[model samples]
Target: MTRIAVRHLGPPRLTAGLDGAARLDWDAHRRVHPEPRPLTAARLVALAEEGRLHGRGGAAFPFARKARAVLDAARRRGRPVVVVNGTEGEPGSAKDKVLLCRAPHLVLDGATLAATALGATEIVLGVTDETAAESMERALAERGLDGRARVVRLPERFITGESGALIRGINGRRPVPPGRKVRASTKGVGGMPTLLSNAETYAQLAVLAGLGPRRYGSVGTPGEPGTVLLTVTGSARFPAVVETPAGAPLGHLLDLCGTRAGEGVLVGGYHGAWIPGDAAVGTRLSREGLAAVGGTLGAGIVMPLGRGTCPLGECARVVRYLAAESAGQCGPCRLGLPDLAGALAALAEGRDAAAACETVRRSARMAERRGACAHPDGTARFVLSALEVFAADAARHVDGGGCGRPVLGVLPADTDARLRLEVDWSRCDGHGLCADVLRGLVRMDEYGYPVIPGEPVPARLEDDARRAVARCPGLALRLVPRAQRGS
Candidate 1:
């Protein structure tokens, strides 16, 4: 691996006022926090641009740019809606959930500001857990923000947390991506332009609103200004959600968590990449800093793998879980993920080791850029990086019987692959529209019962798949994400 040297700085902006205070209610919140600025769209955009604030969501998109887009669209299309996405779907991530629970008022303040900027009278908050939802609701009532804001309990599944999926759920449809490109800034819930961002982003926005541009930009690095919330877990003594400035030293944070040099670290999350344990030390925690070390600040997740566990076995288990979590609307994600997972499992168990390893590599390649979303591609990256970072251990699995270690299963895969695609036998008149619309993903069986590929439809072809679904005359074909469906 190449050595990229960079200086590290300490982060103190976001966590500055907390002082270890956990869960601040309305009264506690107002005590320390200052009054937010009287926000207009232009003022918010200027402040965001000056602070160089980025979304805390996995994508790390420019918050100012996104806000501008939504505000612009609203100018032409009347008042838009604002959505605070508190649904933290990434298993390794807890920052959003924590912020929603502990500092619900801060998040709501940001949402209220954003709603005002967008000329939106309604603000909807999407939360996956009961605690977050309740906290938000109480904050709304206490602030006399009722009628203007609503709390929605979103599905706890992984993929359902996508912005598009959240919009679908808000529209009273199944919480899954529409299998096509739909910009939330242009057409979101209730078919109106919407401004949606993650919980941490809203909190940061609240802070920025209170601090203004200069004061907010005082702490973090030049390129990535402001603080970020990170969920540091796995093998660490102090496994908790932390707030730090953007450019804090990765080594310093690891030391605080009692992580050492040899223990492997998984930066980002399950969908993130793995790097050599020592490679992370001294590196900065900003997006550019992590990228310099061949990692991303994805959803602000950093997990350490202790030397005791078998890396290959651990990788295999995660691959399997990711396979099972597929939305089943994308063929490449559905089929390729399971195939890669099977290959990884075989490699871990020392069964057909060389062949399985090759299959895993091949399947990962085929799955890349083939899904409706980045799920398959991200899963592939995680597994492939594991194989590279733990090459010696991988060799042991192939050349020797196995690593002779236990699978710790330290990574969190809370949900099962209970979600599947089901065809209604009674509704099918066998018109074959399903097969005709989605070419490679769906086929016609002998009886003309649209033979659904037991795999996930690739994301690239999701629009066609959705078209096939919409054109189905019998209404027989339906995409089921889990065995037990929710409204």
Candidate 2:
């Protein structure tokens, strides 16, 4: 693999001292910041409109529209606050972490420029990881921005990365979102309207500021110009961050990463779908391109599943992991994920195929769009995509005892380990005390032990989940906060 220096300030570098350096080398860098021009509000809006810069935070909302919303709302309700969201809690995805650790100054440049344009004074760099927080802090200090921006290390839970949840965490509350629809751009930290976006999006803004609309429009497709950073993991030779022009061919990327001949490629991270290796023949790496293949450029994570690992087994492992990560806020996700995990386990162990498939389908339908957060929906997406991409494997598992391959466990263990609530099957009896305490979070299975969901507990329901944790009969259930859990 290539040993490239992953600096956040500019292009690839060799000096390790430049890892957290603050000097903005405008002329040396390639795409992110080709020049040192300050991006004004009008210029930014124009560039956003021209480049069609979409939010890289999975939602894919138009950047121009979001800016306008914040601008309009700020005009009506005084000034706004710029929030650079570095709280990347998604498992199996490390693009944000890579950017924050390597090129923090680029991200800060974007945040500062955006704040300047929006006429905002205060800036909050919301991060989940300690290393990222330190890197960003160092970058800020290097630029003498101690009082201008504050770096807040948020709870590293999956749901805590949600816009509302991050806002709540910044406001000195647990990193869980309220049940209501609260837009951060309207009422955020300190009751000030906040313009929040992913760390990479801000870095892109810095790039746009440096390279104007027309020059920036010259690299990628007509609509979405510039390059996107992708974390290519699973089965690829070089499992690192790759910078590719938007709308670049998927095949080319796979070749660059030395992806072995595989069954399919998982696009858009865990929440993303899979496409047949042949189907990705001419696929481009853009929102429209991914949409054409029934996928998305979600946070730009692409993983190639090789032929050695049992696809069905890997799917089961991922589904179980996703179920365990649920916040346990809504009834559908909290009650349904464990059942779904059980069904998947059965299928992976060569059980009833029809029953397993039905369970997965039903669980996905129930979980999708039914949670306070998108965790359930994303989990469902992962499961459904597995069903679509590995149909043959599912069929094989149904007929034979197994797929004749090992599990390999390539998805990600951090999320699974963090989210899993171990139950000693040999423990006394099915008291169902945990279920009684944490209503929506834990439900009594046939053998009890309170099967919990994979999503994060909603802000309002956290107290109840905690109560269940406290009242576990066998002391089997433990709420492992991400920080305590060492994620």
Tens-digit per-residue lDDT, 276-331, candidate 2: 77777579999989899888888688888889898877777676656555655666
- The lDDT values for all models are 0.78, 0.73
Q: Deviation in angstroms for 481 in model 2?
A: 16
Candidate 2 clashes: the total is 13
lDDT of 1 at 107: 87
Tens digits of lDDT, candidate 1, 131-190: 888878888998998898899887777777788889998888888877897899999979
- Stretches of candidate 2 off by over 4 Å are 1-35, 416-487
Quick one: best lDDT, which candidate? 1
Provide the lowest-lDDT 10-residue window in model 1: 1-10
